[model samples]
Target: MTAVGVQPSAVGRGDVVLRADGLSKRFGGLLAVQNVSFSQYDGEILAVIGPNGAGKTTLLNLLSGVYRPSSGRLHLLGRDVTQEPMEARCHAGLGRAFQIVRPFPEMTVHENVTVGALFGTRGTTLGQARERAYDLLERTGLAAHADKEAHELTLLQDKRLEVARALATQPRVLLLDEVMAGLRPGEAQEAVGLVRSVRDSGVSVLFIEHIMPVVRDLADRVVVMDQGQVLAEGTYHEVTANPQVVAAYLGTEEGLHA
Candidate 1:
């Protein structure tokens, strides 16, 4: 396998990994994401947060090439991948874990992740890909269940498997959609630790999460959305405390307290 060069700065503690400029998407008459713009620096965990229908998922879809943008551009490590197909983007080092975990029920956990390694990056032998897949499974703590059928796994394990599959692709940038939604509080903390470990391993993460506490604890920066537009962007405390953000999404004091 040919190694993709990592810049010294990017290998350092901080560097810009992904950037979006005026990215937008529409579905029929509905505009799901409108001129959204943001940048995720290398080694940082950037969180996208909003109430339901705020277009967080849609924005991710555009970034991941699941949906083409109606306007604007997407740059991954300074490359314009706005119109690139999903496979092409994956080859370019973009990886995504879906909000809805979709594992091949009949396949073993190891087989499922091995598929990602086979197709992702440039190319490699089946043996090499399987080796990489096993390493990813171990990193994501799914090694114990590698031989089990995907359908036999619990919800939390399924989530970990989704992440493990994405990691098998050797992505430089990963988009995680609600990996913590159904996890218990303790489980959520463990997932956060895994995310931190992924960043420590040189992969940058942009995640959409609804759980406020997890977002507050994990994100280096937070971007809030409302009605498909950015309502606020800042640190977790700054964005949550913004009056406009509260009014637009969190509602009144009673609403927030509710």
Candidate 2:
């Protein structure tokens, strides 16, 4: 599909990098997520889209270890991490970038990334972490701003920094929560390119996005959610064509872009 005049690259499926089975989360009497399940293959860019309060954020939190599932199991790289803490999941090859870009304001761009490199994975020496940070800065196109304080960058740059820091963890899978939230059209296009580059580097990507066009252009497969459960799973065309999805999220065929 063409999006903003850009075509997505061909995706090659590989081993399952992440999987969720019968996942559920309970906040007292509320079932924020219920029996949600999906698999992300190596090198795939997967998008989860739904209306507000559809449990997308809750699902993200479960995957990233911010909240343990009240029921069900999570597997990362073939290991069970259902009960693992956030840091443990990071060590097990799960990286996450939030919708809100929160960089260490007092730290330089390079130093901020360096912090991720140092703590994300085990046995990384400070020297090695510094090297990795600089390399990530270049890969994320922040090399020119390496010495600048994190607070001095623009919104797009902050988004890039969020992604760069996540990549520094050397995760086999990356979870992004609405990374395009406040970006203008041009900046959103740039963010899309960055996400594509990240997938090209061999990391499986799973993201929750509300922008239909971005979901169409970036995702290899689309998973639709509503009322805390997966409503459908297929290509962008297939899911958008589903009548249930149309009523619950898209509103109508033409509303896909609205």
Candidate 3:
């Protein structure tokens, strides 16, 4: 399925890695996502932003296969996956990091990441998964805490753990749901760098973020949503300057740039 009014490579970056075509989601009588569509380029960092209740998280859930779209389709790497389950999507190269960190309290940090490496893809033995998990812990700056239980980490460490676990899946595309939500300025900067490293490692990233500065720093392009649908899509500079996008922020663009 082709994205609405999008040429797939319309952003003039790498090849299209993720596409949403006329996507919609309904819970009971309410349409949480309404005919939204966009394309994310390979190796690019695309951000989704909107005001409260604009369906950003709902849209992310759809993309991550948490909620099946009531209508429309989703394609990953040019393959149709609208009917796929979350695990299927993961194998198809889709990974997701949630805003809330939910690590297993009884497992050590290494053990938690090992679970992801073990299950995210097929054919990996326990030994291989453990090795891969250790590599990820080092890559994510958690090597020093590898033996520590998940519940023992600070908020920032837990958040980093979420991203590390997702990366252990070796996904071609990563979906991040406000990974920066609770981070302090310094920690957020570190997370921003980690995300960049992920993109540099050849993963396309699609994220939902509330912090304007982080979006400006990380996103190559942005999709602005309002009232369950896309209001505009373009570069950070372009969307932030859009009059409709400005009005959607309660008639004040200041909040968006702040």
Query: What Cα-based lDDT does every candidate model obtain?
Result: 0.86, 0.90, 0.89
**Candidate 3: deviation at residue 31, Å?**
1.2
Clashing residue pair totals per candidate (backbone < 3 A): 1, 0, 0
Give the alpha carbon lDDT tens digit for every residue of 120-194 in model 2. Answer: 989999999999999999999999999999999999999999999999999989999999999998999999999
Scored against the true structure, residue 169 in model 2 reaches a CA lDDT of: 95
Task: Name the runs in model 3 displaced over 4 angstroms.
Answer: 1-4, 8-13, 250-253
TM-score of 1: 0.92
TM-score, structure 2 vs. true: 0.94
Residue-wise lDDT of candidate 3 within 1-258, one digit each (tens)? 122365453322477888899999999999999999888887889999999999999999999888999999888888889999999999999999999999998899999999999989899999999999999999899999999999999999998899999998999999999999888999999999999998988888999998999999999988899999998888888888888888886367567656
- Tens-digit per-residue lDDT, 93-123, candidate 1: 8999997999999999999999989989675
TM-score of each: 0.92, 0.94, 0.95
- In candidate 2, stretches whose alpha carbon ends up further than 4 angstroms from where it belongs are 1-13
- At residue 106, give the lDDT of candidate 2: 87
- Measured with C-alpha atoms, the lDDT of residue 231 in candidate 1 is 78
